[model samples]
Target: MNPKNWQLSFFRREQRSLFGEILDWMLTPLLLLWPVSLALTWLVAQGLANKPFDRALIYNAQALAQLVKLSPDQQRVQFNLPQPASELLRADDADLVYYQVIGPKGEILGGDRDLPQPQEDEKLGSYEVKIRDDEMRSLEVRVAYTWVQLASDKSPVGMGPVLVQVAETREKRSVLATEIIKGVMLPQFAILPLAVLLVWLALVRGIKPLSELEERIRARKSDDLSPLDEKAVPLEVAPLVSSVNDLLGRLKDSIATQKRFLADAAHQLKTPLAGLRMQADLAQRKDASEEELKHSLKQIGRASVQATHTVNQLLSLARAEGGGAIDLQSCDMEALVSEVLHDSLPRAMDKGLDLGYDGVDTDSKRRFLKVQGNPTLLKEMIRNLVDNAIHYTPSTEERIGVITVRLLVDPYSQALAVQVEDNGPGIAAAERERIFEPFYRALGSNVDGSGLGLPIVREIAQRHGATVSVDVAHPGQTPPGACFTIRFARASNKFKTNMASGSADL
Candidate 1:
């Protein structure tokens, strides 16, 4: 292949495809999960921060309980909360603090009169509360309560049960919790973006080997089919690189084989071509006698025709081996047969041989006989078959050899068959198979032929996705001559429908 062709192939392979989709599928979820991780971290931080806030509230309540003192009458309680501590607790922007000392009968002793009391059986511990403010904003409040037993004093005032309840709005706790979260989350926020950037960079860096491999391949010479350096490739890409090297090895072998074949063919044809040219030149020489000139000229013409036929067959074989050098297109089998018959008619008349086509139209309308193939090659194939039949068939004044070309459409198998039958000396069963091979002339063949006609026909037919077979023209007895049958892929009804709808080009 040329450098330009290699570049084109590289470009075709590098064109975007499922690789992009797969990368997107793989990385999209990882990036998307970042936000989810952030959310989960925030929730965990809030839960941890609430623990310290609750502990602080409980500490404040326990300290307030210790400030309780009994009144002189022993029936009431007195409280002495320091001014600094009170101011500290009141400085919160949340709802005002409220406290109460309740007797055994649930009578409020000292505190806001409307303060809600705890449930009778509710355990003495720290708990959350919801309080409505003047402005109608529901405030989350924490309250700590404890039941204290007063010392019994046999005085006019009897000892009674006392309860101390301390409550504060959740504003200070919320502020503290926010501070704690900022202290922890600020660093993470700073690092998250950096981590993501690093991850992206790592992904690109990790795939660098693949990029390097691609560059190395692209930079290679077109004719260089040496295997890639597997040790330098990444483990993940080793399989792909190995596969490419294997393909290169096969292609190198194929190209070498084709070159060798071409060289051999040139060597084989050089001698015959040179002889034909020399013979023609000698026949045209001015010193030749009339008789000698006629003989030499006739021999030159025969040699020239033979050389032409050999070159044609060689080209056909080359095209077959090279896989489609000839451009293929849709061809009508029926029309191709008609054309072959028309061309062979003149030769048949000259030889006094009977040549004809056998087939019928449906309802007097031409049947569908189209096949996808090269028209020129099909014509060559038909010409070879018909010419062989005319040249080999025995012809006499009383009995003219008949060559029949029949077109059969096998709808069941969706194939088109062309059979060329002639009343010539039939081929022996053993020779039929070998006759289709190049340069394999049959034994006792009296006709002057280059032994390439059947091979050319077979090559052309094979190129068109068809098969050629030799069978007895007439069975049960020694047939009159050979019959060459060629089967080509027939156009489907869908193709015909497209043609009828003017959507098909041929």
Candidate 2:
């Protein structure tokens, strides 16, 4: 194999499962959103962990603010805390706490001297606690601070405001946050795997029907062309199954056509083959007279001719049906009819028939009058129509057989039509369509024919996008003549509209 084809074949062999595709679509979003959910939960836990601790820090700062009292003479601000209140600072073993107080004149009053003052940008409310985060003693801590207004200004040591601040390390907040994270995230860790498992199981259940359908198709015998059960499948799959059923129905029709063609072919060939065998045996008889021998030879020749004609007709119909190499070339309808008439002259004359052409002048050769089609098939189609007319039309002492091959083009629409008319036993309207089937002869007709001529004509006409119709040529006469018309619609678009409007006589 060539490298390009080999590469293509190799690439096409790669397969993907529908179940796997569905699972990936379902679970990919879930898996991707899981980490997002975790980050949001952790952030929420941290905010929640800080709430109670911050409130406690605010209360301690307020308590220390109350302790800054005015002296008896309203001369100074002082800070004091009960000894029992001091132990509350170190109550929690996991975290260290610190507090500080500063006089307005920058004097250290009470508590740890290392506790930093609030930043200048801090909006400290009067005796209302405000909190911030800071580093104190080389450890991260939460701090709450408030400013107190001293009530004394008359004395020399008058103070403007006192600062009361409380600071605590973040060890307790970290533990609390860890606990919150555990409470919220632990369940999800377990649920995530279960969610994936449930998703996997759901996909398996969802696609189980396809698997069952495959098994049903596989279990059937090779020749079984029965349709899949559309009702049993899902609504989404019913349309696909319906399409498959339609294909199967067409296949069945095609197979039946082939079988019928074979049976009819065998039946049609049997008579001439048997005639040839009998004629040969008779000619070989030892007591056969000279006249008898001559007649046998004649019979043998007639049988062989009949056999050859039947086989050729059958092959022609088969080739037309098979659509073999129909390369289209433009040909004049009038010229083609003239050619078929010339070829069928001998046969028509033998029957004393007036086989003639009624069409446009050959010298004119108008461009619009010409048609596009396979020339060989077009001639074959015309020949069949002309032959049928000559074969069916009979001449007698009273009247001569008149067979006319007429070519017509609509003057306004330019649509082309070819008609073969004969004063023969015309076909009834009911049997006209049936006669187009292979080996289907008209009812009550004694003519010896392969019954494939009209069928071949119809097939070839169809290949060129034309329609064939058979109707009585002369109605209400002694023998209503048959007229076969082939209409080529591509002469112009207006032709279709004209034909529909019944404006064209053809």
For candidate 1, lDDT tens digit of each residue in 329-424?
A: 778788888998999999998988999887644522234477777787788899889998988888888777888887765444455678788877
**Model 2: per-residue lDDT, tens digit, 1-506?**
89999889988956888888888888899989988988998888878989999999998888888888987777667677888889977688888899999888989989889887877777455797887899987999899998887655575434577888899999988889889989988999899899999998888888788888889999999778889999988898889889999988877766765676677679888999999999999999999999999999999999999999998887777667752457888887767777788889999899899887776554333555698888888999999988888887889979988988777676656668887888888888899899998788889888888899999999999989999977777767979888887888755656544333323343
The top-ranked prediction according to TM-score is: 2
The TM-score that candidate 1 achieves is 0.61
Deviating ranges (above 4 Å) for candidate 2: 69-77, 102-119, 127-130, 147-163, 282-301, 315-383, 395-402, 405-418, 428-434, 443-446, 456-468, 476-479, 486-506
For candidate 1, give the lDDT: 0.70
Q: Ten-residue segment with the worst summed lDDT in candidate 1?
A: 128-137
Backbone clashes in candidate 2 total: 0
- lDDT, candidates in the order shown: 0.70, 0.82
| TM-score for each of the candidates | 0.61, 0.77
* Model 2: residue 103 alpha-carbon error in angstroms: 4.8
The window of 10 residues in a row where model 2 has the poorest summed lDDT is 497-506
Q: Give me the displacement of residue 311 in model 2, in angstroms.
A: 3.5
